[model samples]
Target: MRRPLSLFLSAVALMMTATALAAPHPVPLSELFPNSGHARSAIIINKVLERYHYRKVKLDNAFARQVLAKYLAALDPNRAFFLARDVERFENGARRLEENLRRGELDAAFDIFRVYRMRVDERVAGALKLLDGQFDFGRAESYAFPPSSASSPSTARWAQDSAELDELWRKRVKNDFLTLRLAGKADPEIRERLQKRYEGLARRIHQFNGDDVFQTFMNAYTETLEPHTSYMSPSTSENFDISMKLSLEGIGAVLRGDNEYTVVQSTVPGGPARESGQIHAGDQIVGVAQGLDGALEDVVGWRLEDVVDKIRGPKGSVVRLQLLSKSSGSTAQTREVSLVRNEIKLEDQAAKTFVVDPLANAPGLKIGVIEIPAFYRDFAAEGAGNQDFRSTTRDVRKLVEQLVAQGVDGILIDLRANGGGSLAEATSLAGLFIDTGPVVQVKDNFGKVEVETDTDPGVAYNGPLAVLVDRDSASASEIFAAAIQDYGRGLIIGEPTFGKGTVQTLIDLNRYVPGEHNDLGRLRLTMAEFFRISGGSTQLRGVEPDIRFPGADYLTNHGERSLDNALPWTQIKPADYKRVGQVSVDRLAQQSAERIAQDVGFRMLTERSKLMRDAEAQTQVSLRETERREEDKRRERAFKELQNRFLQARGITPVDEDADQIDEDALDAQRKAIARIEVDEAARILADRILMERERQPRAVMKD
Candidate 1:
């Protein structure tokens, strides 16, 4: 039912992997009130969470208070709109929230939203007025707006009065103008763009309907339980269903709201965005446009769904994006990327193999690399009993045999940006490297445990093996990585995984109340959790690498651990399994550490990681035009030097920043310089691992 593996791997190689408001015409908005069905929906959601959510939370005063806190944070993550007094006014309502929820009363939620709407209207008005006046960029001052999330609200002080809030808006408007100015826009263009952007922000706020309010408040309630657990309004539910049922015809990137920005979580293989080799996870999408000639829509503070609609369009359509690269940190300059929308194909995500030719320094030690974007399976074909059914294990099994035939010394499964897929494939894939044994343990809310084991006894390829993972690796990815690490069958490398161990199932709220319309929406509830064979849960503490890369520590405030109320790391009884004890991690780690210390690319990566962290930590930025310009230029110059150093080492000429055109191969060379630092290093480590294993083997002596 799917394409053949040979065809999918024909070119097997190394892997690397918002809407705008239409018119200036403002829509008349009325005070949003909860719909008639919202009350019943809220009550039903409360019941579902209480009975089935993996992290069982009581609906008492403490939880009620937490939900209120989460709600406020969700609405005003930047502390730009709501005042301190507005937040205090809701404290008493917070105490009564849970009781009201059980009684199907949502007035408290609606009340807070009304106040938020009012504050937004006021703030945007102030920002618009500030745009009329000239800003003295020569004067030295700094604008501060540290990023915030639902789990962590802004730690900065909230304005006490209207006058203080107006001043905050003044700085905000100035920052916007300066940002545009720095991007090389003229003063008039900056003003017009800022005006439209601010107007769009105000227009979107007024367009909020009852459904949006209900869904937002409900998510605030559910997200406090777990980040994955959420409530979708009917309209959102429809979009979710469409995306799940068919190939999404748009930029195939998963996005989430981080503070006021829409941050890309991961890119789907075969999608335009992924294939373009531009957009990436953690990149903040600031602006989106329909075509080459269309006006760019500033989507900074727009709703996630509205922004999504602007990006998604018919196949063959061109969508342009202004992205703030995740690796570039918060203060970096934005880059424009153009992508043609297309359907994300199934074959694009299929496992493919690449034979890394042994480096000159390490000849006769070829390491085969298998880049799996996702743990995918053709469920329809499998259910229909198709013998040639496509699956991760089947594809990987074929690739492993091919690699062995190529006489590679070792193999590395690259799961760097893989967000995981089929669960069964994770189990079957583990069986390829290890003898029959338990792969992973699953536990339900009732504490009943189910163990999925490898039934086959024959090994596919059992030589030196390692798994490469990053913070984006999750779910089934963690399962396979954990199994390999537990059985001592392979080495785990890269940063810690995404740490999302819980499973979620969607429940239709319409089914709960018979005769009710399907407009009741749905609740995605976490029902089960995953645990390693060695008794540890991969919930918040994802599988740790045996030999971690340099930048792993700096990314601690990411993945599942960053979510509020994420289930803590727990353990169950160890499953029955024997260890192979094939790896000598200590010696390999020491060798890898030494190489990392001297590697120029690794050194650059470490600095960039630290720079990103430092940028995130900074609460202020200079508004003085010359000072800010110089500061940004210095950062850019330093990065260029790091890149040039790598080029110079490789005997290639360094590229000038002011070059009118860059050779495609040179661009590839530059990418190779930075991206392959880890990939090529991982190969060297595997090469060392292969030698270590050989040394452990008994010497064959001639008996004359």
Candidate 2:
């Protein structure tokens, strides 16, 4: 059962809330993808496009031509593959593909795929050759391999000697070449030898292609969408599940393939592996097994996707792993760890709070700040009567009421890094602050519109407010900020946000009959775009800060609006809301600006951010690996300098030697500490401001 409002409020009040501030159109079903072949291609391409914030295209001939050009350019920007003479010819080939598929010309489409595949292979080969030329294999050190589902802890892997390992690699390379020659059907003896080599090469290539293709393709797909809807080929989906849920029974470590072996990326903090502190990043996983009695399979030559599947299993299950220590070479050690799987709520990536008093301007004013990371909802739990489940709306409502009871003079809602989540939660969450008014406007493909409003006439708290946002704050973050700002409830602070103003509805084409050959795919079409109550589309142009703050946003290629094919920013009619007494923003802006000038830590960070931007501008590959490494070192040095300055400003002593460079454990501890400090600071600042205002009007009395 849901807890009483008062009970919820009590548990939440102590949390700080320095405010950070943080869409889509619909498409016709018929005109989208005409045939099965076109449908499949559209699904793949749309997924890529949507990921990159391109939702305007409807998979028509015009859309196909434009995207194909971009896709081809991404693969070969110089147009060197087909040559300048054949550039138009290759595009003509791609453009006619959809039309040919519509006429049941599968062979023609296959031809296109064959050409595309060849070009892709060539690009991969080029990148690999470049990689080989850049780095010295002699300088490459060996690492511990994590246990796989197929391999056992007892399995002696990675060859006992370096000479043996070199021999193994030679055979592996030889087999790959043999398989490439034997791909076509001709001779039985040659085919048989080719098949053997082919299987090994295919698996290895699968591992490599899995990382590059999936990452690149999904990135491209999402870039076309509104930055949310994405295509996660089963394995990527599993990784996401593990990352979001923060639990996996298999060895409690994340793995990715490097060269040939599956390398341990990192151990999940608080997991059995992390707790044991035995397994670490840079280790390699050569084999894995289920329980002590399970058979050990050599996974060195297996696909990483297949390896991952074998490793992940039910809770309370024991999995044995063969790991090679990074510090040791071929003569490596192994460790077996049994882990129980449970829902691992990611604390660091959740809604957290800190306090800020702005004491220089507002003394003795208790201001609670809540930084909502995302619009998370436990749908299943909520349905099961678990009303206290993790959520943005419920949690924030409770925190607000609690802060009010504690006599906080103001609140700051920080939605800085919130990427966004459920739309229902966004709307409901907005209602917590405002009494009743239209929150946002949603426009469909048919030009139909829906206006969402906060029907509840009760607000949790009414006080001085500020919403702090940055380029990373997007989607639902924009919705909430737009509502708050429109209502004139608080000051919108920070840089312009990530303007992801498009919506996607995942329509399964499989729902139709099979004979239609509509392709068993999902159409992530733009459904509606979000419009702010104050008559502006948070589409391409994000919400502008009322009192701007200096940050890294202005210095680099950032924000959703700074993307390709982004929907144009527009305006809507204003909503009904009584304007509150305006805080002298001009005065506040001047004071904040002057204060930031004196902040040595912030100044150093800005300078470092500019240097990083300059480095980022040069996307060209360095001639030598050593030169690239030197460039990396320069960036690292700058980061360290800024980090040291920040630590010193916060009265923190530097611990470079003992502490891990990034210091995950220490970072969490620091966040907790900072939260306390910021909350105290916010409260003190508000209190001081109130006192100052009272002194100026010394003849006033308590009216209420």
Candidate 3:
């Protein structure tokens, strides 16, 4: 029964190879399990998917398998990494492991692990080819890396040979696959090539900057840290900054990593980065120098963070970057360009507004609804005293003033899916409506409370206000809603807000290290929690809307309190701020109750939502055919109900199939009408009920 020497050598060789490869060591149970981490990466990903209103898996292991499989399939769809036979090979491997697991044969798991590693090797080879062809790091490409430490030495140097580079990528790819598999996508190889193809198409369409790599790395680091502690490389960190910043200066080109070089990913229109026009995504950055006299430093093989810092400078100051254009066929040329950075303006994030007289009959009310997607702030501009820096509070203030000047009778602050932003901005925004009041409260790690108050006495516009929130509204949105409700200044309407009251501080962990290792230092820590001024914390339990409204699934991921490590909700003594004249919430509540009872459209939506929720809650999936049939029926009922509601609300006959199938423009119009009708119905119900109740009450109700 002795094995052949070659077979034994092959097994031994595989083990040696695995050891030599850069593999993540198994984390100690103490550092990785239970309280050490969220034990909820699957939950977080599912929550994000839910915001898109995805009726899929609950926060469970089964869902995790599917997500991992989907991500893998998208990563490599052509079966390029796996043998067509390997589909069955992986299944067989899984079956063996399952059988062994059932029999309590722990040692037999090695057989499956060996098979998985071989398949991973195959996948990595394919990925290496893809990276070779796709990655083109250059001057235009800006990427950053965390400084190397004794534990994680500078793995930043380029490979001696392209083949070696490919091998490194192969290791990274396999690591990525394993991490994702742990996250819950089950079908490891089936439809993988197709998913990869879809992913490639999406990247092309979006002009993605190989951000997938960074995300993968972050996920890997996070997976090691109990699924919460994450490593953000410099370039990735900058991208995060760009997303959060209300404004950014410099050339508007987006650069990404390709092999060892930083390549331009895309162009931002009208930006100093874009205006240089010589740079673009795919163009490699070779050198960067400050001002006219600064010496040029070669950037090839440098981490993107170092390159980005060289490119970023004080506003109006010049930074010269040398770029190797990838788009140029044959002889790729290097060009140097100087750019002076400036600010990104307000019109960027505000909703595209129009005067909607859709119901021609509902005139003068002129509902001024501004869809605020984010509470952004331009820190640089604010620091520079550029009062023009675009911000949520400032932009909204201007918007309200304009609406009031235009004689708008009612205003809707549409933050239906807003994820939230700057706490300062959110509190300041609340000041725009009420004369002065306490907006929100904060409790640090030590439980010391700090109350944020609005000292301003001048109200911007005091007309009828309705804030449209959903499950996606979190952090700042919750604060504003809590304040408005406390003061009785406006009605907070929509689905329950996302509960995310925790405050995180980005403390550079690299500071703890010595010398160069401290450069571009360490991690962001969740240091505190936020609370509503009324004493309740908007932590796990978000604010309940005054009037509920239906929302798409994507809105589910908005609040952070749903996240693990989110500080628990607590309370403090209420602030002594004066409330605006109290608007009777009882009448509004009664009106909403009646409207909900009478609205068939609303009923159908709730029914459909319940069905979807039930389906999503299922641990075991149904047969494809059965699932399809059920989904079709659900859609048919929803469509019919929507059509019936439209007809009833507009006083028009139901449209025939022919009219319904007209055009995209018509469909969009119908959707918008549905939203408007909901708003109108809610508004009318409030006005009528409140007026009637006032008339019914005894005279001399304290109004001057």
Candidate 4:
């Protein structure tokens, strides 16, 4: 028996906010595949969304229009491919998308993709024509390279006609040439590279298959509800699973497409990239080479998956990347890094401990610092009934015992750059801090709330504690931090977290239909929302630290609030939990603020962050070579001076900006030294807290 439509409609009604619309016009497109399987998949996904999604949204005409806008934005976010007329036509077809989806009609979505492909071809051809002619580097006119999603009519006016598009492409090509020229490339080499880059873009457009279009359109559909909800194609689903396991044989870096370049999102902790310490997040890979001696393949405009294929290889193989460093901001300078491919091991992410001696003024206090890369659990081993399966909770419990046995005054759990992992691990880890209580609340599609609690009766280490988080800390990280803060068991320090409080459940589409050996894609739908023990949802606001610190420059661009379709922050009834710890947060915050004001390292960080913010705000670049060179020099000088100031404050000799390159060993030592500086600062803060507590009540200090 077929399921009823009302079930799905009811769920949709709770989540969506749109009215009905008129029937859409029929659009023409090149049909690439049979609609039988696709229609079945669509029906199955909608039914799942209706029955399981946390938010029940209405798939009305108004919702369909939003889907259209989102799809267009995903396809041509920079407004470099599609014209205003194309958008208008797409909107007309979008008016009936809800009706089409109800009947499993995907023709309009494919038609819009077809138009986008044609537009890309035309633009690439026009861009190539400009490369054949001479460009004036001395021109005073400025080119606008606006951020993606800036599609206002005023901003898009430059691409109104073929002539206007031609002029725009001319400026773009000229700018590309200027960038290479500044990097010391000869004119012929610069022209050749620019020509290849545009050709690569055209090739990627022609290589798009039906699956790519389907995935893009479906993602747009899902993202209209929330940013985290998405649909993954069969191949991509497998890749994601491998990534989660951290068992893939590759350079060990997560790569994503940003504009025309493949950018590194982060390196897996035990991966070759992180071990080498040469590759950093936000670096753009413009070229990839096979072994040491292979010719460099310019990958500036290649597809992300294709770039990944080139970077992955058998273990022990070497992969070289030509990177544009993020430290240089918009006017990025290129550098080369070589790393040997290797499998990422679980030990790389294991809880590691370090001890920081008391600060000069406050002696005799030892602080234990434990760095948790992710909230991981050995699922396979646990499922096999292994009693000693590795998990964050168990490992951290052991670490806490070791630290406490060492006679430490306090502990700090460092969670910076920890993007979160197993939810079960988060709950169990929270259990280690408090005796027994509810850890977090979960709200489902039917508005049913369930409280997950820690039933354990004993605490692991009941001493002074702090949880350090940054903008990259999310999901399970937020859960653990929120629980600790709510119970007053520890101080939440550093910047606000990533604000991802929604829970996603993956649904395999093949399970519902009867097809032999069918490989239908999967849907990762938002199934629940996470609420803190204090009744606040950690959706867009994340977990605010009790004592805040100035974050890195990238923090401005990397959080849940920065996303377009993020879920709103909301609250629920406060759960029954009692504060257990007796620490004065107001006093600690005051002490930290005073220290930060007087600390030279922190002042340099603040100045650097401000400079980055200013650079990110600028949208125009001078085409003249002299002015461009001057701008680059000024930025370089500012960064060097900042570095010198930090070094001087730390009592280390500052290296000259143009000093000879340090050996690899010395370079690695320098990186480690710089990282220790931050750890030392965190240790000092914890030490200050311990001292303050001892001053108030000397008996509070724990003795072995």
What ranges in model 3 sit over 4 Å off? 1-229, 233-345, 351-368, 380-384, 405-410, 518-521, 550-562, 624-664, 689-704
- Pick by TM-score: 2 or 4, better one: 4
lDDT of 4 by residue, 222-331 (tens): 87877666777776665555544443466666666665767776666667787887787668888899898997888976766667667777677888898876656556
Worst 10 residues of 4 by lDDT: 1-10
TM-score list, all predictions:
0.93, 0.63, 0.53, 0.90
Alpha-carbon local distance difference test for all models:
0.79, 0.52, 0.50, 0.75
Cα RMSD to the true fold for all candidates = 4.9, 13.8, 18.0, 7.6
What 10-residue stretch in candidate 3 is worst by lDDT? Answer: 1-10
Cand. 1 TM to true fold: 0.93
The digit string of per-residue lDDT tens for model 1 on 110-161 reads 8898888778888888888888888999997898875556567646767798
lDDT of 3 by residue, 1-704 (tens): 00111111221221111111232233221231111012122223223323321122233434333323322232332222334354444444444432332232332222323333344454444663553332222213211222111112222342344455455444444333332232233434412632353243222222222222323322332322221234344444544444444334555544544434566644443456543434543467766778888865656544444455556544567778866544221122245666666553445445434333332324334666677766778787889999788788778887777777777667778775455667788888889988877888877656678888888888888767777776657667788888898888887777787676666445443343335332242244344567776778787788887766654332332234323233455677877777775665666666566766677656655654554344323322222323433544555556577667756675544544334254545444555555564555545544443355457779875865
CA shift at 16, candidate 2, in angstroms? 31
Candidate 2 yields a Cα-based lDDT of: 0.52
Q: How accurate locally is residue 438 in candidate 1, as Cα lDDT from 0 to 100?
A: 96
lDDT of 2 by residue, 331-355 (tens): 2223344444333344433565545
lDDT at position 99, candidate 2: 59
* Model 3, CA-based lDDT: 0.50
Descending-lDDT candidate ranking: 1, 4, 2, 3
